[model samples]
Target: MTELNDQALLRYSRHILLPEIDIEGQTRLLNARALIVGAGGLGSPVALYLASAGVGTLTVVDDDVVELTNLQRQIAHDSASLGHGKAESAARRMRAMNPDIRVVPLAERLEGARLAELVAAHDLVLDCSDNFATRHAVNRAAVVARVPLVSGAAVRFSGQLAVFDPRVETSPCYHCLFPEEGEATDGPCATFGVLSPLVGVIGSLQAVEAVKLLAGIGPSLGRLTLYDALSGDIRQMRVPRDPGCPVCGERR
Candidate 1:
């Protein structure tokens, strides 16, 4: 809300020292608000980095409670946090990491008008939910709200990261890449088993993209990045808007 104080400056001196993000970019980070759609896997790193980076307000939405099985990849929760709401648990870690910002924990599923409302209120949205249904709902809310969305998914040893910016006319929304009727291959980590750090890698990239978009530092739009942990490879491809499709299409 106000200019960075001496303590804040000293705290973020390393970031401020970056040629691309000096004082002006740091201020933007200090005033921005972001909505994280899930507080597990991908959301864990995204939430941590955003909080550590000093995003002014973060609203994390999730209805699931932490389970013993989730400890493998859900770094925000541990034995002490079992049965705690994922959003609240992540919020606790965020607050502990950085007390400078506000973290809102929404311990309910986001759907209908409520989803759109939350999307509209924040400057950006990150989709970290595992299911396609939740991804579709979040996509719809984000497209309607016209807020930029950073989405990531990890299963087994592979993961995908995408950044959709409604602010760009030619950018592809989530639906543009994968229509609602597209085949769904969602398998939770608990069922299929995922490498422990796969989420960390993808989630960290989500954090990087989120920070780039927020701080105006690097490229973060109109592309998809896929990573293969087994092969240790990364690939990127351009994703253009679907002119004839629904959701952010020209007809819409």
Candidate 2:
């Protein structure tokens, strides 16, 4: 663990004041490594909050570049990064906000073996990807690595969050909720339009869950937590793992 100096203590004074997250917890956060699987709306705030909160290392993976349309919710990118890779732009912003953090930018989509390799190296994984394929792949890799996965999604006025931890028996994986590869829904956030602040809400919550997992403090919901920004309601449902499910289940 890295030694905490006066400046470090001052930087994290609020966190150190909390009984759940004292100097020890702060140190754990400073030593933790988190892998974020996207750099768009949800990923943007997730990465930003984690970096500001002193997460030791962050690796952002995304194949897309910034465009004028993304400015509505992708806070990490600004007018200056119009054509730059999302991961690079996010990394630069995070690093500028907190020089103490190590931001690794992967300017390519994460899939196949690359996903597994990246998941294995990080202590925790955040599924901020917009697609179900990448989300499922992240879940499988995290289950295989026995790491906690913090998943969040926001489109239109609704957002959902769930934490999948294969390390804990009975906890459901992402695939447990959506079994089959469903047809791509029309009007993904970009086309349908989303309330920008809604993404920040979900993303910040994801970051909180990741920090709690790393520090071993607070109870993170193992099931699904849904937030409806349109109606202002939050619902949580317990999702049990399927014994016969393919991803993390035993063979029949």
| Each model's lDDT | 0.89, 0.88
Give candidate 2's whole-model lDDT.
Answer: 0.88
lDDT of 2 by residue, 1-252 (tens): 786789889999999999999999999999999999999999999999999999999999999999999999999999999999999999999999899889999998887898899999999999988877778888889888888899998888999999888888878787777775645442368667889999999999999899898877864655789999989999999888888788888521
The TM-score that candidate 2 achieves is: 0.95
- Per-candidate Cα RMSD to the true structure, in Å, reads 1.3, 1.8
Q: Which stretches of candidate 2 lie over 4 Å from their true place?
A: 181-187
Question: Which tens-of-lDDT digit does each residue in 1-252 have in candidate 1?
Answer: 557999889989999999799988899999999999999999999999999999889999989999998898889888999988999999999999999899999999999999999999998899999988888899888888888899999999999999988777778888888787887567788788899899999999998888888888655678889999999999999988888767787534
TM-score of each predicted structure versus truth: 0.96, 0.95
What does candidate 1 score on TM?
A: 0.96
Error of 2 at 122 (Å): 0.3
Instruction: List the lowest-lDDT window of 10 residues for candidate 2.
Output: 179-188
